[model samples]
Target chain A: MTTSTTPRVCRGIGEFRTALAERLAAVPGEASLGLVPTMGALHEGHAHLVRLAREENAVVAVSVFVNPLQFGPDEDLERYPRTLEADLELLARCGADLVFAPAVEQMYPDGEPLVRVTAGPLGAVLDGASRPGHFDGALTVVNKLLNITAPPGPVPFRAYFGEKDAQQLLLVRRMVADFDLPVTVRPVPIVRDADGLALSSRNRYLDAGQRHAALVLPATLRALAAGELDLDAARARIDAEDQVRLDYLVVVDPRTLAPVAPAPGTLALVAAHVGSTRLIDNLAL
Target chain B: MTTSTTPRVCRGIGEFRTALAERLAAVPGEASLGLVPTMGALHEGHAHLVRLAREENAVVAVSVFVNPLQFGPDEDLERYPRTLEADLELLARCGADLVFAPAVEQMYPDGEPLVRVTAGPLGAVLDGASRPGHFDGALTVVNKLLNITAPPGPVPFRAYFGEKDAQQLLLVRRMVADFDLPVTVRPVPIVRDADGLALSSRNRYLDAGQRHAALVLPATLRALAAGELDLDAARARIDAEDQVRLDYLVVVDPRTLAPVAPAPGTLALVAAHVGSTRLIDNLAL
Candidate 1:
């Protein structure tokens, strides 16, 4: 997924550090630095985060790293998309001043880290139950990015994430508080296409029929949120949908991600397979 | 183990943050901030760290929290030692600028953190093996202290630690590097008494005879370093002592804390029981 586009790519840690330092220096006083972490293949969803950063920060750095730690051995570790060039173009349009796209070796010099940040019970449910060790990987790399991009002068360094990764956002919030990290984590609303399908890099994997079937994801979510579908009714919609296999569709406590009594203002989450690609979607009542 | 002495004690995270903010502001531009983390029961060894911090930084903060996370249920979590009054007097004599003494709840607002920083395989041997979850607890709270005390303006913050806890020091160093923290972790030389026994809070648990028996620790360290004692010979030295029980004495790779080929510039660690109290000591060969 390597693109031919460009936007000040920082291939190494030293370059990224230098670029970040120089950028912060150019801001003179009390600069608000914002970070948007992405795995390349940037779409409107990622741009939305960069745009919020651009609106709120004097300096914005978008990390286009395809973190290997977050990908499992059986998952799409190798084939996960990498559209650096196109991502750069999108970020530039969104006013991202710097792009940190380090090589795998640059981010992990000694290979797998000797120490790791683990997500306990909260991470073992929902999507975590489907993909074991996924949240651990996400937390480890996200923590690293938060640290590596930690502002030099404590002028308020914030990291922006999308609500599509609701669990990841919550975990990041917890990790920052638990570690007492000096960074603000902001979550952007989930972005979707005109077709109502939630935007995802994996959305590229869906065939025409699979793409149409994926629409049921948001449809079911909207129905559940609008009271048109109860827990059983949503499960029925997912089951009745063709060309897609439902993994799980249950409402959970947004804070701990635990299954609880369904009610308004709670979260309804779904995970399913459209052909060979897995998809997840969620909404708040 | 509650201490009766107080020196501007910060009871909660908000107070600690505000106190630290005020002290750091008092120093203004380019102020060097130093931190000394201790589990109370401070000795001259702890004072040595404060002295170095006092000399190196314009602002020095000492955290005195007896972290329950690092204490095993069966171990001395209940009686590790807390001499807050004496500890504060020592810090005052050392010219500490601020003392952050947070309660257990302050550090952990949500009970035990579900998200934990794990020490991986490095924490599985020696003291870690003897006391399961010890290193994990050490790493977790140490990381929290690091985050809680992170400089507001990056005026060159450095944390002072003693080398007496060689493994703890190494692990702290590892955690700092692993997390890319914004502060420098400074290691002070191991402070020892005239008798050569390393100073420790747990030394209070020793009786006169047990204290005398504890000298075998430093003696064997010196012997091993001088090439006068082999592994078996060192075991024999401890076996010959009375009122003291040898637990485990092995030379280890200072980097990984695993037993390795003994050599100079590497660590030789030992843990033994002086009466009912357990103690650990290490030295670089």
Candidate 2:
């Protein structure tokens, strides 16, 4: 099959909906749609998700919007990388059929939405505890994206997310189930660089020294996952790294995201600051 | 075109979804779906919504779940009317194709949902202030019902709501826009009894004298709507009723739900207690 060189870009919600409906209608019989939602600073991680979506469905649509609501007042909303040109190139190569890159105003025509999806108790702990209103904002935007991409017919619709954002993945999964959204969540494994640092849009902010120092996050997780370090040992290991300031390194039940005794299926989560950049990573133990 | 009587009833979420999808698939070329969400006392008001849905769409679905989330701690959750046998008879006569009547446990298998849709400031005034977290609960369940009834493919999904619950209808409209839900909200005019009292499931609780007293709500709204009484005058009219106790009588901007001076498009809302049952009514000025 010949692949298209460029994806049809949609800058507005109505345009995106119409484009998807027409595309779905053109298919001869049954058609499946796969969605890869991202705040586009396309790296191997996002491309990996798109590749999976392309392989699994008749049409692949990717959304690239740097959601402002997810970031705190003091957080890096302005400086977050937005490599749209490069993102389209990567998506085209990965066989994406469409890309919805809505502006903030287009997505939220009435400013911040008064009606929103709130992550209840789960949002109160872990990343939520550190970044107040972060998960709520994330869930709200994700909910919108899911509805925005929902198929016009009963055709299969699945959304792809990288397991790198474990808390986000869980909340989104719960949101779909809680709301009965007609979309499937297909989680892609975290993609790491050859140096073991998980790819993040903020990684662009890291200089050489901070980049090297950021490896402490994954390194500690590796030790914990390999049974070479307990929670205390992992905390001590990250603390010894002079350039990396340890935030929280705790073992949590993967299902509930609550701190739990380290067990086989529990997840080890770590967050820290390499220079001024905040980074997080996790591993299934 | 022939219509089926005795609408099919679905008691589980999965069952309702599949039933709707298959029904849509059977339609010749294009199909349309309309949903009427109610708490099942099958009053004339609900019948009005279902009749509108039947007239407008190829398939009409009515949800009859008595949502527990929408009721407050001291509210009439336990005593709220549940007349499924009669509800089905009314829906069949109204040409509804399906009825989703899931039990509380069927709807909330995981107990209380941690994540939910919240109506911010719009939910805080009028009825929301009197029943704290009421709109939040209402929006949460309504959001779920919208998702549950969302067409598999975009085949013109519309939800019918009675304007009797003015706050709720407005919030649902906002939620659809905020979440970019795939459904359109169609508001049917308030369905009042011959005596002018708005039909509500809770109306079943009012005894003979109390039912007559409840007419004060509609009387005040009618006066305000007809320009015979201003906000203060309407409040006084209800306040002077010996059997009716006034809760709040005010004029609010239709768009923002915030208090505003009476204008051409302003809405006058009244909430009062006749005996132990509370009733609310609204009229556009």
Candidate 3:
């Protein structure tokens, strides 16, 4: 059967897993596969990731699951974007072979419970330090997805991830290694606009002026990267800005996300309020 | 392949899982299946559980894995007995369809540093209360085994467990529910000898007199079940006995494994050292 633009969709993890297995089986010898697990509201960033997977693998499975586990009780789980039909069309146009759009019930049938993947020493610092249990959710869901899509034999599978969520990517890599899952995790570069705005589905919540003000994040990160500003000074400069409400601005080691002495390979992550929308962006130094 | 008496042994979880899948596929349509996951050194207790699975399901998969995750840092991991050849022979005689003997590397290839299925309230109480990380190990390995052996499609699968370790059984059941795994957990009666000694692989460590003294566990449990003693008094009585070091004795609810106020459906469990070997036994009150 020829691939369809509006790809075949499965609603639950069980059904999706079964369907994926069956579909993958039809493809001849050792399918070179890549998975782009995401919460679907396909922006330019998501498109870049899908493109990367499409170019790299014989088959690309893009999972659009708005996992509730990762979100805190008071967070934006309820308000998170849900554009499935549009997302599928976009995925198909971007050359994704399969678009798995599972519901909240499908991803988490067991309800709101904790499945933690300990971050060791690094977990207690950086983003993990600020948001408790956040890395746990990311690791748990990623582990489930990896298990579900694991090849039947020793054949290796690669997972495509965006570097925008740097900490999440690191933790996922850790989980794959720690669990010995036969899958390689490849982190794709962050896709940004000409104005340096990192595209996010949550970006939709920004109003016209708020969207303009959001540019300060990319600007601050760029300033830090250019050696024009120190870490604390850059953070203070961003904080002193009137329009953007700074949530967190810190520099740390890119891999461990631990606070370092401003050495090379440091990641400067920033989260702030640009109007009602919370915008998060990071730059590697 | 007509069930081999010369056990078809595998060295890893992946290999074992692949072999099991192929074996299950050979079976004719929609057969009921049961799993009896175990650490090797198969005794009457494990054999009886396998026998029950054979009677219950059209296919029975008996997993023999001495899961290292369940062992604590200072625990007897190295000294734990491994008789894979003998275990398979025993299973073959017991009418088991498949003997899934996976190697330590197979089950935990990348070193399973993280565990699964933690007891929320029931954990810090009974056996969990005493052993610390014991139930976490038991639950994690059991979860992995269940996922590995879960039946395809809507029908789900059933697993048979011995009630000799009442707390372990309760924790496993909770994990199954919490994860919404499509498997029914059935706890079978504790298999015993003519002398009323609960069968265990650990019994191999006991000398003749120590083996005889081990009978006090089941004997004491039987006495409690017959209304010959109260909970605390029974524990104190067991503690007072000679030639054995008492670990713990408590009457708890069978389902929760929580200390019950002397209710009927309660289970009285005893753990003690007979010589250098630790023995545990339980009886439904």
Across B82-157, the per-residue lDDT of candidate 1 in tens digits comes to 7888888887778886788888888898899989988877777777888899989999998888888777544788
lDDT score of residue B53 within candidate 1: 87
Predicted complex 3: CAPRI docking category: incorrect
* Residue B60 accuracy (lDDT) in model 3: 81
User: What is the per-residue lDDT of model 2 for residues A3-69, given as tens digits with 9 covering 90 to 100?
Assistant: 5589999999989988888887878477889999999999999989999998888888999999998
After superposition, which runs of candidate 2 have C-alpha atoms over 4 Å from their true positions?
Answer: A1-4, B1-4
Instruction: Check candidate 1 and list the clashing pairs.
Output: A1-A82, A5-A85
lDDT of 2 at B110: 92
| Candidate 2, residue A8: lDDT | 92
For residue B163, model 3's alpha carbon misses the true position, in angstroms, by 3.3
The candidates' interface RMSDs, in order, read: 1.8, 1.2, 4.9
Q: Pick the candidate with the highest TM-score.
A: 2
What docking grade does candidate 1 earn?
Answer: medium
> How high is the DockQ of candidate 3?
0.18
Model 1 segments more than 4 A misplaced:
A1-7, B1-8, B25-30, B152-154
Candidate that scores best on lDDT: 2
Candidate 2 per-residue lDDT, tens place, B26-104, comes to 8847789999999999898888899889889988899998888888899899988889999999888899999999988
lDDT per residue, candidate 3, A1-285, as tens digits?
Answer: 233566778766667667667766777575677889898988889988888887877778888888776777767889998998799878878888777776666666656543333455445555666667666666667766766665544344789889888878877776565555567898988888888899889988888788888888999999988988887888788777767888888887775566776556788888887766777899888
- Arrange candidates by DockQ, highest first: which order? 2, 1, 3
